[model samples]
Target: MSKLTIKTLAKELGLSIATVSKALKDSHEISTETKKKVLAMAEQLNYVPNPYASSLRKQKSKTIAVILPEVADNFFSLAINGIQAVAVQKNYHVLIYLSHESFEIEKAVVNHCYSGRVDGVLISISSETTNAEHIQKLQSENIPVVFFDREFESLEAPKVITNDYESGYLSAKLLLEKGCKHPVFLSTSLSLSICSKRAAGFAAALSDTGLQTNNYQYVVDCTGTQEMIFDQVKDLLQKHKEIDGIVASVERLAMQIYMVSLSGHINIPKDLKVVAFSTLETAPILNPSLTTITQPAFEIGKSAAEVLFTMIEKKKHSIMADTTVILPSTLIERDSTAV
Candidate 1:
C-alpha cells in the first residue's frame, strides 16, 4: 500500500492542502464541521501525518519528561499511572528517567533535557540533591518544570506534595497516646526535605507533650544497602530497650524495621509500635498488618502533570514561585500500632 499522507486525503476530499493542514492541526481558523469532515476522511484514508513535520511547524516536541528517584515502589508506580492518564489526554508522549536516588544521575538527566529534547519536565528529586543549579539551567533553556512527591524547598517552582509534616506529627502523637514513651523516627537521608520535615513534625509533637529538647531522642539516620539499614535498626534496638515506638519516614524503612523486629523476637505493638508513610498495597496484609500514613500518590502525580501542562501552554516559566499543592494524607491504624 502507498504511504498515506495529508496530500492524498486533501486530493480525495476535494479540499485545499491548506485547509487539510489547518484541520489536522486543530487550528481555530477552520470551522468545526470542516475539521470533523477532514479528520473523518483522513481516518478513512488511513492518512498519518508526519509527526516530525507537525512538530516542526508548531516548534514543539509534543513530549514531556518524568524524572523519578525510582519506580520500584508502589507510590511512584501509582504516580506514573496518574501522569500517563493526563499525557494521553493531551496527546503528548512521556519520557521516563530514573535517577536511582543519585544526585549525579539526576543532574545528568536535567542537563540532557536542557537540549530541548522535551517541552517540559515533571520531577521527583533524588534524596541526595542539594544544588538546584542543574534544574535551574533547564528553566534558563525555556523548559518548564514541576515537582511532585520529593522537591527542593528552595527552588521557586510549583510542587505537588503530601502533608508530610502533619502526618508525621499525628503518627508520633498516636504512638504517645498508645503509651509509647520513647518513639524514634527513621530516615534514609539527612538532607531530603520530606524526611527532615517529617522528623521536625515528630519533634514538634514531642515538644507539645512537655518533653524538653534533650529529654527524648527522636531521629535515627540510616543509609546504604538494605542490609546496612537493617543492621543499623538492629543496633538501635539493641542499644535502647526503652525505644517503644517507631515512625518510618518511608515504607521500605518500615519493612526493614518489621524484619529486624521479627528476627530479634521483638513483638510488634506490645514491644515496639510502628507507623510509616507508605502507599504499599500490602500494608493491610502484612504479617501483623502494618499501620501507615498513606499519601495520595495518584493525586500528587495527576496534579503535577496538570500544572506542567499549564506551564507548557505558556511556553515559558509561568509557574509562580509560591504555587504549591499539598494533598492531605491519612493515618490508617493497624496491628502494627495497636494499643
Candidate 2:
C-alpha cells in the first residue's frame, strides 16, 4: 500500500488540503468538529504525521542538547534520567555531550551546537570553564540555554542548582559538632563556582568556631587519576595528623579518602571524620558508611529541561535571563561522621 499523506486524509474526508492540514495541527482557524473528523480519519488510516516535514515547516528541530562535565557522576546520571522523562513527554529528542572537565572541549561543543541543530540547550559546565562568551553567543542567536548543577554565576541566564553553600555549612557544622577541630576542605578545582561556594560555606562555618584563616584548611587544585588522588590524600593525611575532619566537595575524592584511610589503618570518624557532596548509591553501604550532602539532581534536571522546553516552544529566549531556581541539598548522616 502507498504511504498515507495529508492529501489522502483530506480527499477521504471531502475537505480542502489546507483545511485538513490546519485541522491536523489543531489550528484555531479549523473548527472543533473538523479537527475531530481529521483526527479520527488519520487514526483510522494509521497515518503518522511526518515530524521531519513538520519541523521544516515550523523551523524547529524539536530537539534539545544536554552538555555535562561527565556522565559517570551519579548526580549527572540521575539528572539525565529526569531530563529524558520530560523530553519523552514533550515529543522532543535529547542530544547529550560530555566535556570531560576540559574548558576548551566545552567551548568547542557549544560552538558546534550553534549550527541550528537543536532548539535549546541545557548545560552543566566543566570545572575549567570561567569564560561565558561561548554560551552568550548561543543566547544571542536566540537559542535558549539553561544551567544546572555546575554553572557560571556571571552569566545572566537561568540556573537550576542545589544549595551548595548551605550544604557545605551543614556538612562542616556536623563535623564540628562531632568534635572535629581541624577540618580540611578537599576539592578538585578552585575555578568551579560550586566548589568555591561550598568552600566558602565550610570556611564560614569554621570561622564561626573562631578558627583563623590558616587553620581552616582549603585544599583546592586536586586532579588527575585515582592513583594520583590516592597519593595526594595519603601525603596530606600523613603530613597533617591533626586534620581530624575532611569535607570532600566531590564524591570521587570521598572514595579516595576512604581508600587511603583504610590502607593507612586509620579508623573513620575515630581517626578522621569524613563528609562529602555525593550522590553515590553505595554511600549507605560503604565501609562504615559515608556522610553525604546530596543534591536533588533529578529535580534539577527536570526543572532545567522544563525551562528549556518552555523557551523552545514559546520562542522566547530571554525568558531564561537572570532566572535562578535553587533547590535544597540534604545532609545524610552516616557512620563516617559519627562521634
Candidate 3:
C-alpha cells in the first residue's frame, strides 16, 4: 500500500489539499463537519501525520516529558502506564527522566526541559527537592507542567495527588485498633509535603488515642543506601523493642521492615504490625501478605496528563487557577496488620 498522506485524504474526500491540511491541524478555518469527515477518513486509512512537518508548522515538539524520582516503586511503574495511555491516544510521544531521588538530578532534568524539547511536562518531585526555582524557571519558558504524587505545595501548577493525611490517619488508627502500644512512622523526607501530611495524620491518630505522640509515635528517616536503610530499620527495631507497629511512608521502607523482622526473628503482626503506602502487585504474595494504603497511582497519572494536555492545547499560561485533584488512598487489611 502507498504511504498515507494528507494529499491522499484530500483526493479521496474530494476536498482541496489546503482544506484537508487545515482540518488535520484542527484549524478554525475548517468547518466542524468538514473536520470530522477528514478525521474519520484519516482514521480509516490509518494515517500517521508527519510529526516533523507538523512541529515545524505549529512550533510544537509533539512530545511531553515525565520526570520521576525513580521507577523502582510499583506506584511509579503503574503511573507511567496511565500516562502512556493518554499520550498514545493523543499521538504524542513521552520522554521519561528519572531523578533517582536526588535534588540536583531533578534540577538538571528540569533545566533540560527548557530547551523547547518537550511541549509539556509531568513531574513527581524528588524527596530531596526543597526549592521550586527550577520548576518556576521551566514555567517561565512557557512549558506547561502538571504534578503528580510528590509536589511542592508552593507551586501554582495543577497537582494530582492522593489523600496522604487521611491515609496516614487510617493506617495509624488500624495499628492502634490492633492494640499497638508503640507505633512509629517511617519516611524518607520530612520536607516532602506528602510525608509531612502523612506524619501529621499519624501523630493526630496517636493524640486522639490518649497517647502522647512524643512518647508513642516518632517519625524515623529511612533515607540512604539500601544497606544504610536496612541498618536504620534494624537499629530502630533493636533500640525500641517496645515498637509494636510501623507505618511506612513508602513501600521501600515497609519492605525493609519486613527484611529486618525476618532477620531479627521478629514476626509481623505478632511482634510488629506493618502498613505502608504502596501499589505493589505482589502485596498479596508477601510472606505475611502486606497491608497497604493503596494510592490511585494510575488515576493520578491519567488526570495529570489530561490536565497537562489541556494546558498545552489551549495555550494556557498556567493551571494555577485549576483546582488540585486529590484522590483517596484505600487501606487494605492483610496478615501483616492482622490482629
Candidate 4:
C-alpha cells in the first residue's frame, strides 16, 4: 500500500540514497553501470518520479501551454492539431486554455504563465483584446511566446498572421463585380487588429469602385448565438431594403446569413451576394456553394511551434525572429458570389 520513493529504491538496490538520487539524475558523479542497474530496478518496482520535484531540480517543465480565444471554430481546431503534432515530436506535454473572446479571461491566462509551470506559450488573442501589456509582462519574465493567427498590437514578439486586409479587399471586389450594389459588413469586433484591417481594406475596395459607405445603407452588428445572428440578419434586411450584399468577417455569421435568407425568401446571388473570411472545409458544399477567404491555419500553427522550440532550446537568448510574418489568404470563388 506504500507509494514508491527514492529511499525505497535505495534500499532495494543496496545503494545509499545519495547514490540512487545521483544515478536517477544521470549525474557525472554516478557511473553509467550504476545508473543502468538503479534505473532497471526502479522500473521493476513501479517507481514514478514526482513531476513537480523533477521540474524544480531541472528548471524545466518539459511542457508547453497553448491559449486561444475559442476552439469551437474549425480554424482553431486544426491549429490545435498542428500544435499537438509538434509537441509530440519534442516530447513536450501541452496544456490548453480557452479565453472565449473575453479580454479579462485572456489577461488571466497570460498571468498564470508567470508561475513557470510551463516552459513556453503560444497564444491567439481574444476579440476584445486590444492591449499588449499582459503579453509583454510574460516576455519580461523570459517566458518565450509565439502568436498564431491572431495577436495583440505593439507586442515585440514573433507572430504568425494572414493577409487579412488584402483578403477583405479581394472579397469585396468579387461581390461588387457580382452586381451587388449595397454590400454591408458583418463583424464581431471592428476594433480587433485582424478584423479592423480587413474592414478597412473592404472599405477601400468599395470606395475605389465609387461606392461610399453610406451607399451600403446599413451594417448589421450581430452578436451571441447562431440563432441570434440569424435574427439580426433578418432585422437588417427588413429595415434596410438597400442592403443587397454582405462581407462577413466570421464564417459562423456568414452561415447564419444563408439561413436567414432561406427563411425570409431572399434569393442567393439573385437578391443577395456574400463573401466570407473562413477556413471552413465545407465551403464548396454549401447550398449554392460558398465563397471564402481561407487562411493557412495549420501551417501557421506549425510555424509557431517550430519558432517557439528554437527559442526554448536556445536558452541563453530568445529568438530574434522577424516581428511579424503575414501569409497570404486564398479567395475561393464559388456559387455564393454568383449573380
Please, what is the whole-model Cα lDDT of each candidate in the order they appear?
0.89, 0.89, 0.90, 0.84
Evaluate model 3: give its lDDT. Answer: 0.90
Off by over 4 Å in 4: 26-33, 217-220, 316-322
lDDT of 2 by residue, 123-164 (tens): 999988989999999998888999999899999889999898
Worst 10 residues of 1 by lDDT: 314-323
TM-score of 4: 0.93
Q: List candidate 2 stretches off by more than 4 Å.
A: 1-56
For residues 1-339, write the lDDT of model 4, one tens digit per residue.
338889999999999999999998889999999999999998899898878777888889989999998887988988888888899999999989999989899899888877568999999988888788888888888889889888766677888889988887898888888888888878778667788788888888998998867644434566777888888889888888787789889889888889988898888878888888888889888887888888888888887888788889986325544557777889988888886
How far residue 223's Cα lies from its native spot in candidate 4, in Å, is: 2.3
Task: Give candidate 2's total backbone clashes.
Answer: 0
In the predicted model 2, the residue pairs found to clash are none
Q: What order do you get sorting by TM-score, best first?
A: 4, 1, 2, 3
Worst 10 residues of 2 by lDDT: 212-221
Worst 10 residues of 3 by lDDT: 314-323
Q: Which candidate comes out best when scored by TM-score?
A: 4
TM-score of 1: 0.85
TM-scores of the candidates in the order shown? 0.85, 0.85, 0.84, 0.93
lDDT of 2: 0.89
True-vs-predicted CA distance for residue 301, candidate 4, Å: 0.6
- Summarize candidate 3's per-residue lDDT along 89-117 as a digit string, tens digits: 99999999999999999999898887557
RMSD of each: 3.8, 4.0, 5.3, 2.2
